[model samples]
Target chain A: MSPDEVHYPGAVPPARTRFVRSLGLRLHVCEWGDPDGEPVLLTHGFYDHARSFDLLAPLLAERYRVVAMDARGHGDSDRPDAYAWFPGLIDVVNMLRDLGRPAHVVGHSWGGGQATDAATLHPGSVRKLVNMDGFGPPEEGFHVPGRDRDERPAPGQLAGWLDWRVANHSRETFRPCATLEELAERRRQQNPRLSSEWLRYFAAHGSYHTPEGWVWKVDPMAARNIGPFRPEWIAPGWARLRAPMLALVGSEPDTWGPLPEPMLARRLSHVPKVERGVIPGAGHFMHIEQPEAVARIVLDWLEAG
Target chain B: MTRLRDGRAELALHELGSGAGPTLLCLHALYGAGSDFRDLAAAWPGRVLALDFPGHGHSPRSFGGSYTPENLVANADVALAHASEAQLVGAGLGAYVALLLAGARPDRIGGALLLPGRGLAGGGAEPKRAEPEGMSHARFDVLLQGITADADPDPMLENCDRDIRPPDYARAHADSARLLLLAEDDAERPPWWHAVREADCAEVAPADPEAALARLAAS
Candidate 1:
């Protein structure tokens, strides 16, 4: 289905919604395509929900059973008191086990990194791994020194940091927007390539309407950094992956900062078996910007290997 | 990780070190699990038991969905019952909970070292910070991952409580055998630091567990 042919930009094709109990949280899951088809699991990045695959899942449904998960603290998933990476990796592993067989996994951004860890740490659970621009900073970029560095507490200063964070963020509040259209307009200003209709659809699903106004569904605390996320911590997972992997990045740089060629190469070198490709004229949100192109690339890779 | 049944909730307890010295029950702050005290436990002179408070870390969320001080205290009570006679070392919200337990059952708590608990002053103004314009989800994740790895303060949490009132400190102040560790140059101080001092709550710098131990020995 082409973007233009979609009469309901926000309408996701009929899918069954279910909750999976894992890691002490209820994970919201969406199932599309045929149950008999080969399973292909999709994971969205931070602050995004499973519905993010609406534009791409339909295209893959003809040949694969598409399942998308709303990671804990995002979308319809339950928000945990604290957020961490290892717990998320465990959740993915558990989901795969629940599926009862190895499945193809596709992850975007944060989810991409998690998918990499899943395929690497639990090779038996993942058949194939597709990373959509989820390679984080270069090895040297783990700690962005000087910028907001003071916010971080020293080795013995976690108590102070917790006090500061709780004192600052534990309150209940929402950003007031005039309407859903206004929120979509704000989103459009950031993603110029995304059509207004698609932006509205994304906003409708991504935000909640309060009596006062509309606000994002994501928990603000999910954005906080309560633990470690260094390259060393992530590289081991990448190095251990036994599944064939594909890395898809946008040819044009957009947001995720800029991944220089050398940096990208250095990061990808950890993956044992991997291939790389890029979508032209698309940025970080390449799947949304060029779903057809992304779908074609993913389908071709899945079919080839 | 030790699991204990606390009513309907399950508490994950992390234990470390083994010595003749008094057991140091380490309690972590909000948004933190008992694991946050790993380094502290390693450095302590005695056995250390850290607990993942209900709804945080591996501990299951409270059945009532209440994170109120009373509920947290009840969970802490369950954890405290499992440990031998111990000194209490708590940071952030953990500090507050520790003080509450100490106040309710001073006989069980040999001493309490509170790491600049929540009732101190300051942090009233909205922090002058801005989310970068046009930040994508990937960019945000990068920033978050960096901070998480570094154990740095998150900008997103900077001004979230600008309008909310600080937690009340009367109970903590009334607790017995409590010593407060005031970190140097802290950006966030309890609203009642001066009051705590006026009440003769022994205070130290940077909330050093070793120093608190020494002070307790002297006392």
Candidate 2:
């Protein structure tokens, strides 16, 4: 089916799309709101494109100029030869550079972590920080906090990741979905809390049509695992952040994140100035599920002293 | 230079000399390319193959500085697949990979000759403050000087920028057929250098380059 045939009932289209070059790759940046207004950068989570913020961006755009980027290897951005955590943060910095001024930054899921690190690493580039459930998984392997020595990964575990990369690289092409609904169903499997209508909207923007079928626009190789990363390592940087942070997560449980309260509290304790909130009756994708509510919270926070 | 693929990774492999002896696979250090071994390959009596790891030389860069040790080893394995009987000769990061391959593919790798340089001791599992805020044009140019000649400095810089877990050297030790060679008077040897048995190490001496390498290859 043609792309025009796909539709989202109440979605608001981006006002303009701009491309910014960073590290030799051209990144697609979607814009909304008045050009003269203060900029608010929106970053989406993993497996999501800039358009994932279609509902939220418009609401925030009411008072601020919103720029949402399709991070490298996602949406219309150029795919890099590899995807490492540092480069993603660099992309955020470059986007701020393009804005030519410090802007309030809002990131969801993986983007939230990028926003946090970007603010910490390059303080002057961001005025305020808002992160939505971007903290990594709460499991021991990923979030082990105070260990004296750096532990080596089991040889088998390392080998298994390498083997997986090798096998993933061997695939001739991405798996094809017969229809857009099929794509939405796949996303629903991971995000069952989201309504089917919203998943369809997400899938439409996140994928493109091919002669064979529809496939996600994201680079399959972007999913390749990096060497060991622990959340505890991010604590030092969090403690150094100059901008006040607002951490938000949905009250409802979902498949991926919104780490447990005690663990979340411990991680948040590292930040110097942080305000925490739980979006009631929402899951990981709170903005999509309740845009008006999230917007009210975000707008009030940004407008405050 | 020949291009070979292991999964989606494209590697540039350079070959020199041909004889009945086992093929010597030369791996270069971080930012160094396969051509760095051209002089040695010409000197060796047996066949010699040098490979440009991904993001360096002719091989395509993996985006986002994905130069983790596992990724490097996996890409290097593609070159290993080409040789029927091979011995690994590596310096710096190359040496670390050689030690890993020696452990991972004992059947394919008969022995490994490890030399010292950057990446000799793998970045500890969690590297502290590994990321540079951003690289300026002048700063990048300064880094390129004397560090890399034939490859792009970006990937090399990316490779150097992360905290990577060291490979299980114990796995490499299981082979017991490898040697770690160091300079006689070198003072900055890795802390783990002494842990390698004395019998498995050779101190470089004033001798013919070919004879020394051939002697090392034979063990």
Highest-scoring model, TM-score: 2
- Ten-residue segment with the worst summed lDDT in candidate 2 chain B? B166-175
- Write one digit per residue (lDDT tens) for candidate 1, span A76-143: 88776555454577678767866878999999988998888766656777888999988876655533
- Candidate 2 residue runs with Cα over 4 Å from true position: A141-154, A170-173, B5-10, B39-45, B54-66, B103-107, B119-125, B129-152, B155-162, B166-186, B189-219
- TM-score of each model, paired residue for residue: 0.61, 0.84
Give fnat, all candidates.
0.00, 0.30
Instruction: Please compute the TM-score of chain B alone for each predicted structure, in the order given.
Output: 0.69, 0.75
- Candidate 1 Cα outliers beyond 4 Å, as residue runs: A1-11, A138-164, A168-173, A188-193, B1-219
Candidate 1 residues B1-219, lDDT tens each?
Answer: 899764445789888666777777877776677888887676677778898876568876543132444345556766777884677777766775665566555556766676753422223322112322222335434544543343333322322222221233432433343554444454645544444444455565435556656664333
| Local accuracy of candidate 2 as per-residue lDDT tens digits, A1-305 | 55555566657879999899766678999999999899999999988999999899999999999999998889999876656777677788879878989999999998999999888767778899999988766756432223232243444444555566657776433778999899889777778788898888788878887788888888887765554465666555587787899999999987667888898888888788999888999988998988888999999999999
Q: How far off is residue A90 in model 2, in Å?
A: 0.9
Q: Model 2 reaches what TM-score against the true structure? A: 0.84
Candidate 1 docking classification: incorrect
CA lDDT, candidate 1, residue A167: 51
